[model samples]
Target: MALDNWFQNWHPTFFQQPLHHDPIHNSTGKRLKNPTNLLPIYFSLNLLGSEHKNLKGPSKVDAHFPTEWKSKELPFHNFKDDLPGEEYDYSLPLRLSSQPNEHYSSPHVDSSTFEKSIYTKKHHNTDETYEDHHKLKALEITGPFKTWYRWKTLDFAYPSLLERSKAIAKGDFVVENNLPLGIEVYKDRIFMSMPKWKPGVPVTLAQLPRVPKEESPPLMPYPNWDWHSEKSCDLITSVFRMKTDICGRLWVLDSGKISITTEEAKQHCPPKLLIFDLETDELLDKYIFDNSFVKEDSLYSNIIVDLRQGDCHDAYAYMADVWRFGIVVFRLADHHAWRITDHLFYPDPLAASYQLHHLKFEWMDGIFGMALSPEGDFHEDRILYFHPMSSFREFYVKTSYLRSDGDHDDGDAFKIMGESRGPQGHASSSVMNQDGILFYNLVSRDSIGCWDSRKPYKRENLGVVARSRQTLVFPNDIRLDQDKKQSMWIITNRLPYYLIEGLDISRINFRVMSAYTDEAIKGTICDPNVHNKSTYLEPPIDEDCY
Candidate 1:
């Protein structure tokens, strides 16, 4: 059956609703006449539907309503009053019809029926609001894995008991110390970064099956176990975050430090960037940052790669120095790097104090979150949006200034965009999708926030897509894949609690969740189709001098 015909036959009430009156443009800036038509195609090909039989990976699931669903239940927070505008209808499911031309008798179906038909379920205690029923929930892929691993038994399943005993005695693996930070998705494997913050982190960078049979699978060292040997300084020391570019290569930002959160911390090696070919699982290139660009207190936390016009050789990487308050720019063509510093890179003393999950702590982290605007024919200059972890404000600068070797002494080059995110607007990692929508982690509210780049960055424009106190305690990193679906991958480690008290091994402490970028922002203000009139905030002419 045709995809559109299936939707019309199965659920005619879906299209009977009011269509968006405002003009809507897609990622390519082409106006869409009826966005609802595009919905059926995505549903049939990528999402949960009877026609999604050919879909692969963890995403593939039987669309038929089961007697008892075994999938994890996602608790969604209610935010109907928070978003002001007409909400789009993206809650209906695409089910198979008994016969052609069949349609529902009523256009007004109980909202609960729509909610129950989908994969996610809301918290029982919360009242079912319009936002709660329509907001697309994040699906947990693989998570809450036992941090403490019996390496020989888990990885090999044949190593002698003596070998496992020796590993434990040598302090080679500590379960509580190994926390998953960054996450990236390739073709069939999901790569994660297990930074050496305390101790017992055997492999800093590891991979797992994207669709695992077991709920919590063991982490396998990427490439092979030999690449993570501690005897060699050339191997990965500690990796907090990484990025996979469009050229089929993984860009790893190794912090080169061990026991970072403890007094025994030491610099194991100079911070470096490692590029590995994902197809062959081989190291392509490794570049050590110049000492002049690094500092004694420097900590390389996150990385983002930019490829111009599909040119692999003519690429650039932007690395965030969280502790030193600067951005390190690397050119792939010449393998040269330079550092740019500004007062905006520094942390906000007031925002530094944080309270999450009833745990209080203070961390003065500088320049952490970084995202790039989508490149297009009309876009003359690609903008880079960034913000410090300890600040509620967002800032931006053009790539032209960053790529140049000239001095950036003039403060006008860096401009703060939009108003403050308020007291609870603190965010961790951020990424911009191909549709010009920026998705970020709201660490304080235990939610994921989104803002369309075409709209002004304000509280009214920013919308919360997903929120679950149990699942999104502290979303450490978020990345958008290059697939047609543009899936957004997130890793929540309950970071503040782990750093202050400790994580309860008995409970699920970590999670890897994902949602389709298009579906995630479908009905909220983040959707460019939703129209709202508001005054744009003017950029501050002068910045406060430190």
Candidate 2:
């Protein structure tokens, strides 16, 4: 992947300016490929620093606990480039990199506007095409973004949430690229996909005519991230579905889930598939499915999108629970929920700790880790889940019942991740690339385990790629990073409970916190003690999956 060699295949757009060797890697002995071949991988790597223009936080490397990147508030920061110990500011070199101040306003809309302009030209070639001309002309009334967020007080983490909270707080439409902590890409944009809530509850903001109106004020207003009315605001503002493809056209997968509960009547919520044409703010068609084949009263849960289009036609999509059981599949283009093509898996009753709990639902605390790999057929769609066994639910790390390879229900397929330690938060994460699959050890402090799904699909060790004694509450969101270390970033949401005082901090307040990753995690600290038994995170365990 030499730079000069990569230049051979890169498009002219990538070489618009004079290309020179990056001084950082000039003398490195290790062979490196050119940047052009690594566009997708690097795009995910440069999330925190040089990649995104606006980086807010002190340059000094403070102790990791509650670092600037961990805050669950609004995103804002001062301009900084290079690692604190290093002295290079990449902000100046990268075109899309926003100055710290730029984050306060909306990000660039050139991508979106350019897309629209191209469509206009295609529709109206003649100068006298009045209707087409008028259409593009009128959209100028309302520019791309209705509102932009630039964080001030907190570190870089809050901005991602603020985008969700701000969209809910404000009633107008918005275009966003804000995402989980440490993600550097500023181009994963989706136009208006959230349910706009005023004070509390889910409500769609259908205000139409994307173009600006003469008399009406544009709905894009800077709204506070704090929710005034607190009835499940997070769920309402949560992203329903996500889609990504190679070259921005090849399909990957579209996956999302919803949660809903109301008195006697209940239902599973699903994130709507929002297809985005990033260049233009226009939303493509949604992946709506027909649910007639599932139980008449069935509701949807968590999902996984594996969009691979090749001659093999082996591309697939997966749907399962957030913390526990249930996995189904169909083709990428299939929209019928009830018609899970060939596979459906549930927690096996005969497994070690996952002895059957004869309840309406499966497990409660075990939903954090869920990922699949095509490396081996035995575990192709084999789903994985972890939960804190509740007083009423069953506990299991890798439930065997969830895997359906013929009629084999031997209950020997699962691997136990913990004994009594409770896992909680958005910490449940699983991912797969060509190499292996990875997840944070829910019970171990800052420990992440990888199972080589390549040729052998067994839950064996590639050894611990990263570990630290630091008691990070939960390495909640695990991201792959081939650039730094094994290339992983763990996002932990820190919630402070008043355990010492009369106040009950157990109340569910989604505090914001996270952990940026690196090659070495040996020196990090761990939580001082185990969780209280009464915490809501404890999952009920049976004899099946331990």
| C-alpha TM-score for every candidate | 0.72, 0.39
Cα deviation of 29 in candidate 2 (Å)?
A: 48
lDDT tens digits, residue span 364-388, model 1: 6778888876665445456788888
Strongest candidate by TM-score: 1
Superposed Cα deviation of residue 99, candidate 2 (Å): 24
Tens digits of per-residue lDDT for model 2 on 150-267? 1111111123455557655673322222122221111222121121111122222111122222212212210113321224423223332222333232111122222222133323
**After aligning candidate 2 to the native by TM-score, how far in Å is the CA of 133 from where it should be?**
40
- Candidate 1: give the clashing pairs: 174-200
Model 2's alpha-carbon lDDT is 0.26
